[model samples]
Target: MTEKIAVLGAGSWGSILANLLDENGNDVRLWSNSEAQAAELNDHHTNQHYVPDFHYSESLTAYTDLAAALDGVAAVLFVVPTKAIRSVAQQVAAVLQQTHQKPIIIHASKGLELETHKRLSQVLAEEIPADLRQAIVVLSGPSHAEEVAKRDITLITAASEDTKAATFVQQLFMNDYFRIYTNNDVIGVELGAALKNIIALGAGALHGLGYGDDAKAALMTRGLAEISRLGVALGAQPLTFIGLSGVGDLIVTATSVHSRNWRAGNELGSGQDLKTVIETMGMVIEGIPSTKAAYELAQQQSIEMPITEAIYDVLYNNADIKQVIPQLMRREGKPELQ
Candidate 1:
């Protein structure tokens, strides 16, 4: 069956996924905020600004109007940044209300709402009424937009409390190059996906500081501990931390050059100011805002996340990266499992 799907946000990840759906024989409507981006995708079958030198499927269409893009779609994927999730979800709710269409709501975005400290799924649920959506799903794992654009083999998890919903998403996205796994641990999957970006920033900073593989290995190991601690405290399954969305994502994001958070952290450790790095990159470094949210959440939960605190200080407090590294190293040693 050829399902009509609405993929919101024409960023690199969103555009790639939209193209993948088209390849999988679906009617894909990719929505972008900019008229030029929409025209580029529709006319040239390319999104050169985000994913350069790549031609998208000709059957995949682009739209600037949210209502028209979503008209009669069976599923809607939210791929916008965490900061924009609420506003976009609100608009989606209004459109669905008018059309009386209840579609499956799936989000591939990671990171919590900075203001409310709520997960993206929670924000979507609050903004998009249950009556207007069949179910909420989260798609996350070690996949990167650049690699997926190359048709590299990628595996990701689709999580939802509803088994049927999760399986439906699995079937929707699974293909020869892209494989999907279904998980019922929505909390763990979302937290694991969001928190890994913070640790990836730290890994990049280590690399920029001339630290070798040993330092990065230590950072990733201890970083997973911090992630598991906070995630478990926030009602996630302990075993999920060891799954694809957990350790798998941490390993890939922290070690890969394709990660924006890692690249941003490298610049920070190389002595560039945050403002300069952000402006030069011209992409959202999710770890910056995610670090703040995680730091606050750790304090509220009384969970000791030293790595997150260190990164948070560097990003938000103008703390020197060199000084922060020594401070982290000098902290009182404890049992490794604690």
Candidate 2:
């Protein structure tokens, strides 16, 4: 049976997923908060601003009305930036309360909430009525929006405490080109997804600062160790760190040109100021915010996350990026894995 799926946020990821759902023979309603963007998508079947060369599925419809897009949907896939999750969830809760509809909640954007340091799903649970949705699923992995838009072989994980909800999401998104895996480790999945962005930022900074592959290898290895440490402290299974949501995600985000976090860090390493980089990129770099949140979390939990702290200093404190390289190298010698 085909389900009516509401895709909130008309960014590259959201648009591509909506098109994929249409391809999978589902009724997809693509919602954009911007009226102008919604009009362009509906009239032109394109979201050229975010994905300039990709074509959207004509069968998929676009809407500016949140309630209307979700009118009869079975699930919602949120692709907005991390900062926007709370506001959007509140709106969804209001709409659902008004319409008395309960849809499976799924989020694709990554990054923990600032100050609160809550995951996207956690934020949703706090804002949305508990009876609105039995469980919230998180979709995350190494897949890039550009490649996924082209139907490249991409794999992502759907995670929730409810295995049934995760499996349902896997079934909803899986196709010939896109594979989905269901995991009950929501903590591991979301933490891996959010934390890798910080590592990716460091990787890009290293690249921009003229470091070679050897440096990147060391950075990723150590980055994963710290990620695993923090994650395990927060109740994530250590083995999950070696899986798609962990190692797989770190490799792709740290290496891919399509990653906004990598690109932003590249600019920072190239000597651009944070304000200028943000203005120039014209998109949300999840890593920057994630770095801050991770840094705060590490301090509160007393977890050692050196890479995250270095990146946070660079982004928030105007610390010299080039100088931090030797500083890291000069740190007292320690075992490879702690």
Candidate 3:
């Protein structure tokens, strides 16, 4: 069936996903906040800043107005950053309220809200009226926009409490190259998606500090443990941590060159200031803000996440990564599962 899909946020992930859908013969409307960008996408068929070296599907359209984008769309995919979620969602809620239409809400962004520490799904559920969205789907895994744009094989998870909703999303995007797995564990899936960036940041720092592959391996393994611990405390299945969204995501984020969080950490470890790095990257390095939320949440829940705390100190307290990492290594050792 031909589906009308609205992809909000014309960033790398958004543009790529929209392009994939268009390639699959779906009528895709991609919405970028800037009117100029929308015009560029519509006319030139290229969003060079986000998804460079790739041509967008010419049939895919771009829109600046939320109402126009939502008109007659069966589903809306939010590919914006975490900080922008609430604002964009508010606009979506108002439009849905005015139009009296319900659309399946799917979010690909991964990051916890800074202050509230709410998962992206929780944030959406809080902002949009329940009547507007029958269910919210979270799409996440080890996939990168650049790699996915190249049609690299990607296996991601679409998680929702509603199995039917998840299955709908799974069927929407699965293609020859992209595979979707439906999971009912929304909390664990979202947490694994959001929290892995912190470990990626730490892993990048280790690489920048001239550490070997052994350090990277250690960080990924221990990071998964902390992520599992905090995720389990927040009502996620412990087994979910061993699955694709958990260890799978951690490995890719912590090791991949395409990761923004890893790049940001690399710059910071190479002695650049966070402000400078953020300005230079010109991308949302989600781990920076997510680290703060995870740190605060860990403290609130009385969960001990040593690697997260070390990364938090380096990023937030201006602690020297070289010194702080050693302290992290010298911490009291216990059973791996404890």
Candidate 4:
């Protein structure tokens, strides 16, 4: 049974997912915001800007129009950068009015918005109609698009309050090289997905500072602890942090060369300004704004997240990263878990 799938955003992740769906025998439509990119995918069967070295299938049509892509689709996967979630959702909502049967919407992005400070799912809920919001699901993990696109072994979790919605997405993406796990902890899944990028920046900074495995390990462990604390405060199950979305994602993003956040932090740690780092990266570095939102979430929830605060200060307040490191080390000693 082939499902009709529409994936918005023609970035690496979206193209990878589109390829995955096509391999799984689904009718995949990949929508690019830019008509030129869409035409490139349609005519050349390649997305050179993002997923280079891979050709899309004839089954996967690239459309610049949202309604044309959504037409007769059973599922919609949003894979744009986190910052573009709202704008894309609003456009989808306007076009989806004619279709009474709303497809299950899945978001594969991994950051919270800065101005709205909303999660991807929250953005979907607000922009998509209430009826359609019921089908919102988050597909996340440490799986990098480049690896997944190359058909490497990858594991991800699809979470939704509605079990059926999650299951639908799981069926749409799961294959031999890509494994899918279904979970009901949407908050924990999304929070872990978004926050790991922030921690990855910290890890990159540590590595850039010439710190050995011990410092990286400490940062990773403590980072997960703070993320779990904030997750618990925000009504997510504490144990969720121990699962794939939590420690799993943290390990991958923090260590992997594919992580933009880690790479950006590496540049910053090596004494580059934020502007310089962004210019060098040439892609959406999610950790910058996510760090700010995580800091605000920590303060709002009255949870202690010192590492996140330090990262926030370094990114937003222009605090000196080298100076902050020593300040963190000099903090009054306490029990390890206290």
Per-residue CA lDDT of model 1 for 1-338, tens digit only, reads 57899999999999999999999899999999999999999899988878889999989999999999999999999999999999999999999999999999999999999988999999999999999999999999999888998999999999999999999999999998999999999999999999999999999999888999999999999999999999999999999999999999999999998999999988887888999999998778889899999999999999999999999988889888999888999999889878
- Output the TM-score of candidate 3: 0.99
> How do the residues 1-338 of candidate 2 rate in per-residue lDDT, one tens digit apiece?
47899999899998999899889989999999898988888788888889996778778899988989989789989999999999999999999998888889999988999869998889998998778876899999889889998889998899999888888889888999999988889899999999999999999888888888998999999999999999999999999899999999999999988988888888888788889989999888888888899999999999998888888888889889987778888888987767
User: Taking the tens digit of each residue's C-alpha lDDT, what string does model 4 give over 1-338?
Assistant: 59988899888888888878988998888888798998888888888877667877876788887888888888889999988899998988887876765788899999998886778899898899877545889999878988887788988899999998888888777878998999999999999999999999999998887888999999999999999988888889988899889999999999988998999998889889999999878689999889999999888888999999999999989999999989988988888775
Query: Which digits, one per residue and each the tens of the lDDT, describe model 3 over residues 128-216?
Result: 98999779999998899999998999999999999999999999999999999999999999999999999999988888888999889
Candidates sorted by TM-score, best first: 1, 3, 2, 4
lDDT of 4: 0.88
In candidate 3, how many Å is residue 32 off?
0.6
TM-score of each: 0.99, 0.98, 0.99, 0.97
Give candidate 2 misplaced runs (Cα > 4 Å). Answer: none
lDDT of 2: 0.90
Candidate 3 clashing pairs, residues 3+ apart or interchain: none
- How many Å off is the CA of 37 in candidate 1? 0.6
lDDT of all the models against the reference? 0.94, 0.90, 0.92, 0.88
* Best-fitting candidate, scored by lDDT: 1
